[model samples]
Target: MLKTAFAPMALLAFVAALPAAARDVLVRDQAGFAAAAASLEPGDTIVLADGEWRDFAIKLVGEGTATSPITLTAQHPGKVILTGRSSLAVGGTHLVVSNLVFRNGFASGDEVIATRVGKRWSENLRLTGIMIDSFSNPDRRFEDHWVALYGRNIRVDHSHFEGKANAGAMLVVVREGKMPLDNRVTLDHNYFGHRPVLGSNGGETIRIGTSTESMSDSHSIVEDNVFERCDGEVEIVSVKSGGNVIRRNLFLASQGSVVLRHGNGNLVERNVFLGQGLPHTGGVRVINERQIVRDNYMEGLGGVDFTSAITVMNGVPNSPINRYLPVRGAVIERNTIIDAARITLGAGASDERSQAPQSTRFADNLIVNRDGKSPFRAEASLAGIAFVGNVASADPKVEGVVVERREVKLERAANGLLYPVGATAGAPRDLQPIAREATGVAWYPKPAGTRVAFGSGATVEVATGPALAAAVANARDGDVIQLRPAQYLLAEPLVVRRTLTLRGHSATLRFSAPTLFQLEDGASLQLRDLKLSGSAAPRQPGNAVIRASAKPMLVNYTVDIEDCAFAEMAGAPGFDVIATVPATLAETIRIVDTRIADVSGAVLAGHSEKGKEGFYNAERVVFDGLDMARVATIADLFRGGTDESTYGPQFTMTDSSIADSGAVLLSGVQETTITGNRFVRSGGIRVTHSVGSPHTEIAHNSFTATPAPVIEELHYTGPARALLADNRVSQ
Candidate 1:
């Protein structure tokens, strides 16, 4: 019809030659502020003033509303200081910003926080009072994180995040699915400190989510914050979210708090966990489920030896709906803990009923196990779980006591002081008062109890073969050999010595061909629900599944390989060569939830003399959650040989999916923690340094169509100290 009437008169003559859509605009330097904020259109606002401009880079799109927004303010306040080095991106949406100071930025191996703007539900954005620092470099990779918020009604009020510690990822919030419409976001009165930017790619100060999408709910409101000397206060979640509100914050001298994976209704009220004397300190940690840790307060500190000030397992160990439960449906009311050498509660994924949690409720808590010398005590289990007033042991035991830790005394009927007698809390200094002395030393709770139940007493469900030969022939003296998920089919190789625990409930095993699953030579075994392989492995069984030697091995194993194919048999190579091996071993071998296809001579475990210790002193090994279709030729991924000894090869990775593999060699390993992994078209990642390797750490990992993203030390054999921080390499 005449091209729709001249296409609406050519869009009204291109909207009358555009350009009159203003709302406050101004910018200086750098191509006139990137051509006036890229020719703003959406309710514009670009006012930037205050001098000192350099090599700035920005990447923004369009969008604005919610009351005519689209700002980029600066002007009145020290004006502006977008220093050099490069990178800055402000994604689409109702963008708004205030007071600026985004200093000298630069990225070495696999650049991070180079202003890679946010995502998800584009909403009213605001980042007030900004300042993101980072200068000094020793090749430790300087971190420059100001914002990494992945969208959602954003608002980062009163901000300031100093830098230099490359375990980068300052303030990150992720959520891109599962409705609830993302909800109001706010990080009120902020300030996060910095210093050690790369001492092995430090831990997170505020990591937020891990992402696999789905499960939203979303709602955050962190009030009055201040976390100086911030040394890794993580929050690694995979999915599931809820309204979170952490009030009155102040976490000085941190090195604690890790709530990895899965979450629900949240509220960590009135926070304050100051710890100076570090040694593995902790205050809050809960793996999964509906949470509401009320009235928080954990003073001083006391270095833990095992784990948990708070913990709930199963990020993956047999992930029974993420380790059991709807969890009472979830709730851990009124909290006021102190000291805590180790105060684990409802572990084994909230007290295993096969990982059941459907209505977990633990009222008015006040755990002060410090006096009782909590080396690690506190295990809840009122059957399914539900305990009203908790106060662990200031004393009241002896009556089938399920899970209790009670102490309440709140006389604040309008300022009456006295808040501890079992304080149900109404706020009396939030009942934090306890610091009289405790700057370290504390460890009691070794009645030989940490309850790792799997099978025992009157034939526990099923473990087969006379309860797996009486749980490894009456294992004692630190016992732990639990296995029960079924399917074990070996003709040989099932030898374990001393301190055993071969547990399994959903376990599956098969070895039709060249079988061999040894951990002999005084085996210090600890295997969990497993699944082995074998596809003509009488000739394809060199690294079929496992074959360990050495003694001090403490493996928290996880292997799953369906149709079978790990390596070594016909061409001879199914697990070979290994003499000593043990330079700095602590063990945590994991191949992970699998569905792997064709594989040969490259699963793990190597060492003859080079490195002196077999399994290259496996302090940590992880092949990672798999679904590979191919992993042909083999090099260093499972190697540590080439002699000349001196140590190398420590590994760790999450959510793996390596294709046509090869390179992943740690030319002498020492500290490696590659996170949220996803490397396609592999064959890249080589770090060198032997003769007692130094350090190597890579983070957040995400490399698509990889050919090369990071390959440090092409030759240099020692003193390289590699650390490629916060990666996200594109094709």
Candidate 2:
């Protein structure tokens, strides 16, 4: 095999019939090269001397079989440069062109192409170790597809392409004519860089598509390529093509990345992506079916939260209709995402037709968010999403964060079984009288009777997981509560409104009703080492097993909950769990070291009402090491209204894990910082209602399975004051 870094050894070996004679026919000038190339014979060699060859139009007029192909080589490798008034067209098959430079070629007004017309249809074409440059300047108006290819058995390797100053698309492959051939193209080890000086009208680095309709392709590969500062994008568009691969490519300062339309059985893996101006349409757009995207890096430039990191749609918008359509079915696995404050999966808008169903499977990934929650959405009917063995955490508060107590109870149980006695199981009955205090009052722990019992002297309740409700029902003010480890079933969310503490361990707390826990009416409470969950059955209603509903003017009321786990057990409802509350005025809350799993919508912090709805100003909230797995509504928080008037930013989550399902929802507040967390197998993140210079800092996090916009600053309303840095992001 006559192997060259640019030429495929397979193609070289196939042309075995070519004579091995080193006949170097030298052409010192353009005219000699033109005449010689026009009459070139098979097994012949055309060598150009080490000098400038200008105004030459070399077209293949002879045929070359796989066994006897012609060779065009530079006499001194890259010393020979060709400048032509028109493209150099090669219509013959099994050709080898290597180690030469093609620059300043005059392109037709219809197409700014420097190579042969892909429509000429040649198979087994090898373009290796060549440098093609277009220095046409920025003012030139070129056509869409540069370097258009339309044949099978194509090999483009070890090449360098630069569009010095032009507004054009690069490396386009499409079906040109009726006798279109299935392309088996190999694009590898290439360098694509656009002129950064041009600025405004730069071009995408690579594009693969069809001309009239979807073109069927058997095998195509794009690997080990480096693209930098190219206004162009790297994309795949197919109406009927199947089986392609894009792997191990480095992209920086590109417009966007995508896999759209009818291409099936495609694989995108091991690619590194960076930069911005992400089309404003999102990242990794997929409208095709049966595609596998894995082990890639997708990072953004500065702080621009456009959309999810990976967007898979069943169809495209109605307008600008193309030949290809969208469908369902995809596999997204093991890709690292960093610093994207928005959701990772995009299924179009809520009202679009051909919307993507939640059918994509996700597994074995690591996701992180810096200053905001992850934006990853999982719709209904999407099944078999395995999210196992992942960690989600964030940084600690340096400016001294406020801790609050929302729900507390005092009761007793035995041997992992509920006493089935009292109604408010572990809630201290004696404390009920003092539970309701005036608004804007802070309640600190007292060293009195029952309050100073177990677990940091927080409170000891005599209730197991099963008897938790009975214990709460019998709880009184200033009562100590001790609980055992096991399933303690409850009919309603335990509401704590007194200065009390509830402690439990080695026990499970089950809820038979909605809103597993609620803290309202000026209550200050603390909870530790407890497991709260919804009914352990399926098809439940819309309600969070643990909810905190407080009034707008309520102040100094805190809920400090730590080291607890919440889950929607087997066959539980499809959605809504963890936390839910209607918007109230201002309050303080904190949740630490908690785990939520297998439910729809993990947390809905505040729900708003109509007309002058209560204000919600949460003072200090900490979501430390909160891991959410397979739970719906992992990130689905909504602002009060659509219009700008009714909004505020008052929540901050530090150190949390949202690994799958739903999207991150941010509502009204002054400032919110989401630092050091993981968001995997989920949708995007949404933030609204910013007050003052309501800043959101997303620093040092991982998003391991989906594409999303990293939210740095919101437009008009306020600045996100987003700071994104030093992170690992993969596509």
**Candidate 1 TM-score, C-alpha based:** 0.31
Q: Each candidate's TM vs. the true structure?
A: 0.31, 0.47
Model 1 has a clash total of 70
- Which one is best on TM-score? 2
**Every candidate's lDDT:** 0.49, 0.52
lDDT of 1: 0.49
Candidate 1, 1-731: lDDT as tens digits:
99997999999999999856676756666676778776677778777767876656555556777767778767775357766654456666787767766566443222323223443334667877776665323232234344556656788776666554343456656554542246467877666664321212223556455434323456767666666555432331112355566666666555555343455666666666656545345556554566666666655544341124455432233544433334435565566555556555444321122344435665666655435543344343435446676665445342323435444343332221224554443223533322212211111111122223333222233456445554555565336554565665555455544435444555655544343444543344444555445532455434444555444232222222222223222244433311223321323445556544455544544332243222343434665665554544322433343221112245666666677655566655645666666777777566554322244667777777775445454334433356667788787
